[model samples]
Target: MVRQTLTKHPWWKIGVIYQIYPRSFQDSDADGVGDLAGIEARLDYLANFGIDAIWLSPIYPSPMADFGYDVADYCDIDPMFGDLDAFDRLLDGVHSRGLKLLLDFVPNHSSDQHPWFIESRSSRESPKRDWYIWRDPLPGGGPPNNWISDFGGSSWQWDAATGQYYLHAFLKEQPDLNWRNPDLREAMMAVLRFWFDRGVDGFRIDVLWHIVKDVAFRNNPINPMWTPNVTERDRLIQRYSTDQPEAHEITAEFRALADSYGDRVLVGEICLPNDRLACWYGTEDHPQVHLPFNFQLMETAWDAVTLRKTISDYEASLPSFGWPNWVIGSHDAPRIAAKIGEAQARIAAMLLLTLRGTPTLYQGDEIGIGEVQIPPNRVRDPQDLRQPDLGIGRDRSRTPIPWNSSAQAGFSTVEPWLPLNEDWRERNVAAQDQDDNSILSLYRSLLALRRSHNALSIGDLTLVDAADDVLAYRRQRANEILLIALNLSDEPRPLLLPENTCIAKVLCSTKPIRPISSTLDPNEGLVLELKEKS
Candidate 1:
């Protein structure tokens, strides 16, 4: 039996995405913050990174309460990140360089300081009061329900000034919008149109699953496996609070808006189980999110059996003709190197880039950058500040990319907002960019190979084997075929090449030496041209 997979429809469907956190990417002014001009200054550097698109984290007008994730003005850029003019130039640079730009759209919520929220909370009689989800206090004067915030407290914040409570799945300072409101939907759609009109490519919609809370506003059921060690938000299953039925309709609306302007893309951030996650793809004829940001690699264990099982299951679970994407690292999670150790990080990289779907790489992971331990006094993440004991902060992974071996790692002139450790200085880009065996070089090689190979870019994936601490797969496009063998362990593992399959040539390897054989060295991987025996 042959299983037909979804063919590529757009460049984004087949290309790689690079994510940059503006505040930490590069500081052109030496003001301890990265800005649009800084990003423009480094356009050539990023343009050469072999990525098809750049997904910039929120740069909108903000109060910095939750960094840029708490967007205040959707239509303008923040002063710290440069104004709208700077943004226009950056967009132009991205387009002029023949690269795409994906803005981080924070539509799930807006900063409470925004004018709409300000008016919404002014009084019960405010015309814009219903623009945000507001519920009166219980008869006894507590929260309206048990909804919890992602930042470690109650999701419903009591607003004494308004004599009611407002819902916020994240921080109290960022209230959830009333997505059910027709006016609010039109306003958000208009914001999207505003950016698309300015030549922006698309958006990486943040927390797409969190939109459209349950209309009834019921309390979330308690998780049967809740433990004292986990954060409070995880205590509940979040059935009614998130991933509600209305979300799909909202997703379709978003899809319609993006479709109106042909050639635009929409990559949503969704973290869900395979079954629930597959629904985001919409119908076979009508697609919702172009790429529903796959993060299974980042969330799953790095072992061979685990990776093979999840990858196969996810692939099989996709809707007919549904495209898949993968991400091994992100700003909110620990660096892949830190989670899986340095040796396995290389294997993870090969799997991410060579997989059947699109791959998104974090800024500094290309150089094998590990998590930076934030000192207690230097910690600034709201997650860390609110719940220091939970160990879920993001500052460690959000450190600036080390551009050189000099002080500040060439990321800034003065001391950066976050300190760079000795590892950053040693593994800086300037040092590894010239070394053929360095992680950066390996990344470049893999990306180049994938880009040039038709089998790798738009091909069908078939699982070959998952055993002996090695996971193997085959990617085929027409007559072209390539075998990807990954050693998840440090000790040597005999690669189980598919029956009648032989290695014609070695495409690339993670280890220093490339062997045109079946046996894989410790923590090594190879993409080889496969030829059948005569």
Candidate 2:
């Protein structure tokens, strides 16, 4: 693991991050695909949109096998997304508005089309032969072991020339890099430095936990608790193939590299539970990711009691130096509006922004974007394309953002890569920007409140027993004491405050800011100034 650098600047803890799925974010070229120029044109929109940072998903040159997750070249931009000149201009525009830009880094693997992998696969005596994971087939002429791919197949792909198989955790076109190779590790580190030199603020590392694997090449055991109804990839436990101890050392190296750039952050995408997830923070002396992406909110049940337990447990379990983060929706999951209905999504906005730590808002959740149905032929996600009956496609959540009611929803002149929602005209940025009661306005108000109030941004949290259907927490930093009460049920729930305590005033609410009340209307939440009795 890497050593600590005395003190750290807490931009991640202090600000909100917005994830932009590049292809669906904005298409300026009108070529049915989004590009850096598109994002550059919209810098003012994001700045006024109230986010502190914009994390762009994989803009590296790729063949788009996994929608840019498969990196063919790390040091340059894809022609489809414009050239390096476009990226530099985008960076300049972002900093001009006092906002940060974080690029997505995929350290675990590279596209098969990458020169390093191509050379490594050419012959056994190639200079870069050891740069990738390649092994001889089993004695019985099967895969090296029983390991499975995330995209529903064997992780090994046979190479015709080398007479060996290479490991690919996802698509066969994406080869896993050999992190154990010192030369390979240095090369990847150089890629990080290359981007840092270009003035990018941070990175959101993709699939961080699966980067390393077992040395013995042992078969993973069958999952005892897995059900047939679950994803096919979960049929076997990933204990042996994933979450190796060496992964921490690799991440620490990344942390050290990022710290060298001064104030740049490393956000890891790890989907493990809280206890196991804590390891990514490293021990007290050495640290790993600045913020291991917290996906608990996306996975938790939509209710007061459930979310309360989740937040409390996560907060308590954090390592001493580790800071927490929250994600409501993302390119991978269903949007919040569709998950629990639009009304509850407003309460969700209050819950996300008012929480103690930093929050990440998905691109479209602010305007209450729901799921868009994709027909069989139009589906782009490989998961659904592979298993059409499972109904687990991710394309619905990743539809193009509806800016206006114009043709292509103002995203493109031509048809978008993914279809826009049918309600794009009714539920759009142009429509919501004017409506004070719109979800977009609620998000802005929450962000403004968060920025204006020190207590909400950096404060101690104390959970109160408001009611079974209501969630209440007090945040206090010195004299700035406030209470947040959320009604999670469809019916009105009375706010049951503790003894000798009363709300001074309601600062904000799902409906409207009003006088302190004993009960919250159905699906409403209140941020209140609190007063304690003598």
RMSD of each: 2.9, 3.4
Q: Show model 2 residue runs off by greater than 4 Å.
A: 1-9
User: Which 10-residue window of candidate 2 scores lowest in summed lDDT?
Assistant: 1-10
Q: What is residue 473's positional error in candidate 2, in angstroms?
A: 1.3
Q: For each predicted model, how many residue pairs clash, with residues at least 3 apart or on different chains?
A: 2, 0
- Indicate the worst ten consecutive residues by lDDT in candidate 1: 1-10
Tell me the lDDT of model 2 at 174. 93
Q: Give candidate 2's error at residue 171 in angstroms.
A: 0.5
Residue 305, model 1: Cα distance from true site in angstroms = 0.5
Task: Write one digit per residue (lDDT tens) for candidate 1, span 1-534.
Answer: 111333545878777899998988899988988999999998998878678899999999999999988888999999998998999899889989888999999988999999999999988999888899999888987999887788888888888787888999999999999989999989999999999998888999999999888888898998989997888898998899889888888998889889888888999998889999889999967678988888888888778888899899999999987888999888899999888877788888899999998899998888888768889988989988998898888998888878998878888999888877558767888899889998888888888887778788888999886458999999999888899999888888887778887878888999786545547788988998989989
Put down candidate 2 lDDT per residue, 195-311, tens digits, no spaces.
999999999999999988998989999988887676778989888778999999999999998988988989999989899898899976788999899999999988888989998
- TM-score per prediction, in order, is 0.97, 0.97
Best by lDDT: 2
lDDT of each: 0.87, 0.89
